[model samples]
Each structure stands twice: as structure tokens, then as C-alpha cells.
Target: MFFQTEFTHVIELFQLPFMQRALLGGILTGIMGGVLGSFTILRQLSFFCDALGHSALLGISLGYLLGLNPSLVLLPFAVIFALAVSYLLEHTRLWTDALLNIIYSSSLAIAIIILSFVGQYKGGLNNLLFGDILAVQQLDLVLSSLLLIVCTIYIGMTLRTQMLLTVDESLAIARGVSVSTQRTVFIVLLSLVVGISIKSIGVLLVSAFVVIPACAARLMSRTFTHYVLLSAGLGALSAVLGMVSSAWFNLPSGPSIVATQLAIFLTAMVIPRLRSVTHSPSTLPPQV
Candidate 1:
């Protein structure tokens, strides 16, 4: 009786219009994060994604100053930032970590300074910083759906080339892949994903949203295709579960989603060890 009542309550909660929007938004964000995150993990560009998220604040501030929607500015700003970083990595002698740190700190500082100049901005910066998924609206859903479709088509067509480039740039070049172009395109797409995701997952948790599910999938997958699919699946699962849990428990949606991903990661970490222990030769011998 208790279980039946609880299940009905869960269904009723999801039937709310805001909850429905939040769920759809969360799913789109999760799938996008997972799909792009696989490449970031393989290319060791996770920090680059984080830097992009931080740098987006500058764009938001500029948007407010110019009386434009922040989302309108964010994608272009992120693309420019990504291209600059890619160019620097290719031509400069500085280490990747140092360059990213410099950009991340400088951009964030500049954004704060700009915001101060904006003076009494009524925009909810907290939503940008920490996220408020429950605040998702119809336009957000429409934009997210379009972005997801575009990203999916791009990834589907370039998956093989991207995989080869990720594995070995020289080999990819030998096979006639344009290493520079592929990397640039990938960086731009990643920037777009990170930019869109900031609204739902927040700047603070975007990296975790993108990275954690891929990491968890890595532990469970034995092949590249499997890894990608499982990562996306896990991401979608976590988002749904997190949103439901948030609605039921009155928790912050972004943090709840991240917490769910963390739990999956820990479970992925432990399951293999548990399996090994359970199937060990010592245990088999004892049984014999």
C-alpha cells in the first residue's frame, strides 16, 4: 500500500508542467554532455571544457551590458574562446594546463568586473552559476532540442575520423584526416554543448556533468562504441533519477543530478572489485 501510494505520487509530480519541462531539459543536457564528454575524456581536454564554462560568464556580463539575452551571446563567445585556446595550444610553448588556468582565471575576473559595471542587474546570476532546472521553459526546451539534433548529426558523421584523431594524430594525418580542422570543429561543438548546458547544470557543475558519466562508463565498457553508448545511457538515467529525486525530496536539481552521477561512478568503481573477489580462484578452490 505504501509503495503504491509513493509510485502514484511520483507520477503525479511528473505530470506538473514545470516538472515535465525540467525532465526534458535534463535529458537533453545529459545526452549532449555524455556524447561530447567521451571525446574530451579521450583527448584529455576535460579542463578545456571547464575553462570554457568559466569564460562564458564574460559573455553573459557583456550580454547584460548590451541589453541582449545572455544565451544569445554565450555560444559565439564560447566558440571564440575555444578557437583561441586551440590556436594557442598549437603555436605556443606553454603547457596546456598553464594556458587553460590563465584563461580561466582572467576571464572569470573580467566577468566579475564587468558585472560590477552593469550595476543592479536584475538577472538571476545564481541560476547561471548554480542552475535552477525547475525554471526551464518552453524556449529552453526548443533550443536544447535543436542543439541536440545538430550535435548528433555532426557526431554521427565524424565519429570514425574523431576516433582516429583521438587515438593518434600522426596516424590520422597519415590516413588523410585534416587534424587541425577536425580538432577545431570538435572544440567548437564542445563549446556549444558546454554553453547550452550551463543554464541547466550551471557553470559550477558542468564539468562534472560532462566528465563523471564518461568516467563511470569507462569502468564498465570494453570497447569504444560500448563506452560511448553506455556513457550516454548512464547520463540520461542519472538525469531522470536526479530530477525525480529532487522533486520528491526538495533538493537542488543540479546538485541532485551530480550526486546521482557520483553515486554511479562509485558503484562502477566498486562493482568490478566485488566481481573479482566473488570469482577469484581462491573462492573457487574453497568451493571445490
Candidate 2:
């Protein structure tokens, strides 16, 4: 009865406008993260997402300095950062990991230096670092929905080529897939995902949405199609679970969401092990 009552209360919380927006926005962003996150995991570009998330801080700092909404500044800044990173990787000889590492470090420093002067005005530093999902705005949801639509279309058009390139670039090239072009296209879409989501999930935890779900999906997926759908499902599931738990416990939504994903990861890991044990030949004595 107590659990039922608490569940009722949690459902009631969603009647608030802010909660409505958070749930809608979180689900959209979660779907995008899961979709691209699978490709990112395959391409070994998790750190690239880290660099983009960190670079968002620079844009947010600039927004504070300029008296603009941080999301406005974040959009262009993240898109440019993604393009520049892609260009550098294609044009230079530096290892992808090393280039991202330098950007990650430098961007963090630059953001801190700028924020130190203007951070007092943009509703405090905590919001940028940890996020405030209940404070989600209407515009944030609109922009997130638009980006999700664009990403879906882009994937529908290029999914096969993207997979081919990731699996073996030489084979992709022989098959007439333009590696550089596909990378550029995907990076641009991914930057928008990070930009729009940062407002709700924060830069520190934004990458988690894109990473953890797809990772957990990898353990149980039997085919590529299964992997893609399962990853997105896991992402959306985590967002909804996290939102309810956050409303119930008054916890930070971003951490709550990521924690749910972590729990899923643990469950995915253990289930495979349990299956192996259960299906193994019996070792116990056969009692008459």
C-alpha cells in the first residue's frame, strides 16, 4: 500500500508544466543519444563526445559573458567545435585520441577562465555543471525535438555507409562510401544533440546518455538491427525511470538518469553470466 501511494504521488508530480517538459525533452534526447551512441562506441569516439561536452562549457561561458541564453551560444559553438575537430582529424597526422585529449584539457581551462569572470550572472555554475531538468524551458524542448528529427532523417539516409566506414574504412572506400563526408555529416548532427541536451543534462553527464545505454545493449544484442533498437530503447527507458525517481526522491535528475543506466549495465552484465550458469550441464549428483 505504501509503495502504491508513493507511485501515485510520483504520477501526480508530472502534472506540473516543468515536469511535463522534462519528460518530453528527456525522452527525445535519450533516443538521439542512444542512436548515435552506438555508432560512437563502434568508432571508438567516446572521448570525442567528452571533448564536445567540455567544449560546450566554453560556449556557455561566452553566453554568460554576452548576456545571451547559453543554449543559443552552445548550438553554434558545439557545431563549430565538431567541424574543427573533424577537420583536424582528417587533415593532420595527430592521433585521434591525442588531439581530443588536448582539446579536452584546453577547452576546460578556457571555459573556467571565462566563467570565473561571468559565472555569477548565469544562474550559478552548478546548473551548468550538474543541470536542472525540472527547470527545462519550452524552447529547449522545441530545439531538442527538431534536432532529433534531423538526426533520424540523416541516419535513415546514411546508416549503411556509416556502418561500413566504421567496420573497415578501406572496404568502405572500395564500396564507394565517402568516409570523410559521412564523418562530417554525423559529427554535425551529434554536436546538436550535445548542445540541446546540455541545458537539461549538463555537460558533465551529457555523454553518459549517449554512452551507457548503447554499451549495455552491446552485451545482449544478436545482430546489428537488434543492437540499434535495443540501445535506443534502453536510453529511453533510463530517462523515464530516472525522471520518476528524481521526482519521488527530489534528487538531481541527470545523476538519477545516469544511475539508472548504470544499474541497467550491471543487470545486463549479470544476466549473461546467470544464463551461462543455468544452461550449463548439471554437475550435482542425480539423487534417486
Q: Write the residue-wise lDDT of candidate 2 on 1-288 in tens digits.
A: 988988899989999898999998889988999999989899888889988998899998888888997777889999998999888887889898998989988988988888888747545678888788878888888888888888878886777887788789999999988887888888988898888888888889999989999999999798887898888899999999999989888888889999999999899999999999999999989999
| Residue 56, model 1: Cα distance from true site in angstroms | 0.8
Query: Model 2 has how many clashing residue pairs?
Result: 0
Flag clash pairs in model 2: none
Report the Cα lDDT for candidate 2. 0.87
TM-score of the candidate numbered 1? 0.94
TM-scores of the candidates are: 0.94, 0.94
